[model samples]
Target: MLRGLIASGRLLANRATTQPARLSRNLVTAAGPTSRCSLPHTHHHHPVAAVPALARGMKVRSSVKTMCDGCAVVKRKGRVYVICSKNAKHKQRQG
Candidate 1:
């Protein structure tokens, strides 16, 4: 019984030491900032440039809509409309 316990304890100690080394090696190989922001490969690409704002000349006004407080007059669908700055749909599109 004593010999079996001693052997098992030694085996457990060996397993514990080996596990940490293996885990550390795996962690070292796997851990880092991944290429999350990489753009997909594509053909027929145009040079990237910042687009000037469509509503650059528009004036801001208090919102009359139910969704938000601040609003801006912008042309959409060949007609001008009041777009609320604090709208939930606008927040999601921005993100």
Candidate 2:
């Protein structure tokens, strides 16, 4: 039902208003439209932030933590986390 609503655009009603909150180009700071601004060639555009090239290598475990090479089971914020500093690939969490 939730997927159907999202696909039908009903769940996206709030997204239309939230897009400006993460806008890459700021209208208030950027130069006005070319037709209205006197300096049409001098547009004040802000550089977009570069995205980090990282990978999502987390696993969702059905049980709490693992006994991997260096995994440690820990409880935090009412949730369970399995962190492995030596083998970061074996990191996972469950709640």
Candidate 3:
């Protein structure tokens, strides 16, 4: 009796798993083979030459290599921007 119960339980579990697959198949047929909502019909065509002009021939500045000197904030004409280790850590914590 215990073995029979275990077999029935497994059969029920298998049927439940198969139910979702059958439901998906029926939904696909009803929607039509070409009109699947999960898959996008129209794909956006992106430009092959999507590279920025600056990236083509950009010279790296030595100052920009170690930008802000590991400090959280820097004042260049009194305009503040997040550019350091502490600032990044602080931003992540805030988020």
Candidate 4:
């Protein structure tokens, strides 16, 4: 039941991002209507931080709120593990 809920939530999130995806597509099309251009040319600074930050916050909040399998494993280690783009995993594993 919990897994179903989680899966449903993921699906909803994926659906929600469709707008941004479409917007990006439109931006690409508009940038070069006649020719194929690279995506980096379309980059524009937004008022707020980029989408990656928002996604990170959502992931952190969800992980903190729910005691899911990965969180449980982290809890057993007596330390909190946060996912960051720079450092994927916080600590190095010892054999």
Name the top lDDT candidate.
Answer: 2
Mark the 10 consecutive residues where model 4 has the least summed lDDT: 86-95
Q: What are the per-residue Cα lDDT tens digits for candidate 2 across 22-66?
A: 563455346554434334577678999899978757687778657
- Choose 1 or 4, whichever is better by TM-score: 1
| Residues 1-95 of candidate 3: C-alpha lDDT, one tens digit per residue | 99999999999999999999998998889889889556556888877987665422222232333234564434355444334563343211111
lDDT of 4 at 54: 33
lDDT of 4 by residue, 1-95 (tens): 99999999999999898979998789777876677765566677769856564322223333342233232223436544443334333322212
Candidate topping TM-score = 2
Candidate 2, superposed: residue stretches over 4 Å from native: 1-57
Candidate lDDT (C-alpha), each = 0.57, 0.71, 0.56, 0.53
Write down the TM-score for model 2: 0.38
Return the number of clashes found in candidate 4.
Answer: 0
Q: Using alpha carbons, what is the TM-score of model 3?
A: 0.35
Indicate the residue-level lDDT of 58 in model 3.
22
Local accuracy of candidate 1 as per-residue lDDT tens digits, 26-60: 66666644533344677787898998866433333
Per-candidate count of clashing residue pairs (backbone under 3 Å): 0, 0, 0, 0
Ranking by TM-score: 2, 3, 1, 4
Q: Where is the poorest 10-residue window by lDDT in model 3?
A: 86-95
The CA root-mean-square deviation of candidate 2, after full C-alpha superposition on the true structure, stands at: 14.9
Angstrom error at residue 49, model 2: 13
Residue pairs of candidate 3 with colliding backbone atoms:
none
